[model samples]
Target: MAEVLGAVSSIVTLLDLAGKVIEYLKSASHADDDRSRLRDEISSSVAVLMMLKARLSPTSPHVTSLQTTKTLAAPGGPLEQYKSDLQTVASKIVPSVGTGRLKVTVDKLAWPFKTTEIKALIASLNRQKTLFNLALQDDHLSISLALQGSTDALGAKIDNVTNDLDNVKQGQKGMVHIANSTDWPELTVPVQTEAQALEEKRRIEEWLSPLNFWITQDDTLRRRHKDTGGWVFDALEFRTWIDSPGNMLWCPGVAGAGKTVIA
Candidate 1:
């Protein structure tokens, strides 16, 4: 519970920093395309943090969750680092209160960050967002493991989450953005002959897998007991991962955890 409280405090501070960034972006009259994009990206990142805050609220379901929160709130950890970076950005972009009127006016009309800098900030935000998403998934898995009463299984899930966190801390892929349908008209695909299409299909099949995954999926579904793993479908992390394009739900459990059935 102490760890959870610490994690929530970090999240609240981050939210406050993020709000500053958004506010300054909105107020910048001379903001260009990059700044606008940065604003949108920051907003999306904030949503991930909001979800994380909700997960840490009240009592988390299991020990793994407490472990995760502890790690996140540790000194020099991901959440602290994220907060530091965001504060730096906010300091650069946000206008100072004690500035002269003319200086404030000039600041409001000028964009503070370079294009390269904006891109780097966006990338950092995306990385941290991915890390938080993984944390939320860890919390969900912890709940399931607690219900099953498998201590070994819970430890294994904790290990998996820790590995994932390390990778994310080293900088990994972030939220997958799905382009709107309106962007379809901008795409230019080449025309393919019947032979070419067949060749392409063959390549896709080979790339997907050497064996038929559909058959394996069918078998797993057949083995699934009715109402089993239904909680997974209803979990916040699961629904968020589904509704948000390119987001992944990392469900790690020992064998017989019904992973395939949940899928």
Candidate 2:
């Protein structure tokens, strides 16, 4: 099954590489030297793809697919080479097509893709890849949740809540209330202005939302600032607040002397 699918995958991969190079050319993104290098790379990939095809089952279903293609149907094109190689391998697997489980299913099918169709498919795939990459870079896209309301109000019996709200998830891809304990999930609180949206984007990137902070190094007498993300504070100028042993805070001591310790 993989052999059959591998043949298709390799063909698509080859086309994708070609498509990307052409896109780079149109964008003027790379120099002539880069284009030369990429063309060389594509040629090398094709050679390796051919070698892999030869090693797979000669009776694989793709040979039947290749036999009817116009490009290689005659001589010297991809289909001709594929068909010839399969024949060389076929006898070892099966004496005749009737006896073989992997029998060829030849057809008079036309080229499945014209230049425009191929280009469009490749471009669409590229667009999807770009979108996912952009999503990954976005801090908001990396789902996180913090309690929107108080856990005490949630009640001791409340183990979960529906994640359809209070989650910065991407189409069912992010964590749910289950992760709200680790970091208060960043909210996409909507505002009336574009300025507010831009501010929210920056605030998310700046790590300003209330988070789980702990003292690390346990021995610095000066606790090192640490967050759930494992990012460490390297500067010591503000280490006094963390060093004071009495700085055990639920929040940042923002309102007043809410909680204190007696030594």
Candidate 3:
């Protein structure tokens, strides 16, 4: 039992470190004019997180009941049942949690909640972009679909956005230069954008710059916390908190009850 408690303590320590890494990764690119810098920073963090995930993977089992019920399985939860199930899960992982699944899951996510939803969305978008690039070389993938998957108006708009990526592939075939110039604005036409705005925005948003999305979301989390009675932030309730600007330092999915979000 002593050994078990010790391991749990170690797991908690690693989680605290990982949380700091995420917070640092998210804030590393503190810039307004470029997004690629943010993406690059995030990518670095993601790499570290992946390594940590491999090192601290947790055990997550898929539990099923009433063999026939498998046909009706869906995500919109059976709330009370989910709460009860996770309570059981919490008990099972307390002392003997593995480094692969339980540890990763506990540290990286909020069970029964959409905590990592934004990260998942970003990852999915990146994967789709990669797959699209790969399809460029395939003979089977039709040009139209490969270039732009057919769908609705929003789909068409997204397809238009993909064109910039195609332009990048073409432009890369030429020469590269590390351009450095402060984005200046005239009091007259400020916010009207200029020659390098598109490229700058791309750099800041995609890979090597501080990202707008990350900053906005971090700020949002902060505002949400302030709105709640500072009680939402009692350190005693949390096992740990990273240096991040949000309430992310705690054991998220492990919380015993819902902390209401009231204005």
TM-score-based ranking? 1, 2, 3
Clashes of each: 0, 4, 24
Q: Sorted by lDDT, highest first, which candidate order results?
A: 1, 3, 2
Taken over the whole model, the C-alpha lDDT of each candidate is: 0.65, 0.33, 0.34
CA RMSD of each candidate after superposition = 19.4, 23.6, 23.4
Angstrom error at residue 113, model 3:
32
lDDT of 3 by residue, 30-95 (tens): 232222332453344334323322322234121111211211122321112222322332333233
Residue 148, model 2: Cα distance from true site in angstroms = 43
**Residue pairs in candidate 1 whose N, alpha carbon or C atoms collide under 3 angstroms:** none
- Which 10 consecutive residues of model 1 have the lowest summed lDDT? 172-181
What is the TM-score (0 to 1) of candidate 1? 0.52
Q: For each candidate, what TM-score against the reference?
A: 0.52, 0.19, 0.17
Preferred candidate (TM-score higher): 1 or 3: 1
Identify the leading candidate in terms of lDDT: 1
Greater-lDDT candidate between 1 and 3: 1
Better of 1 and 2 by TM-score: 1
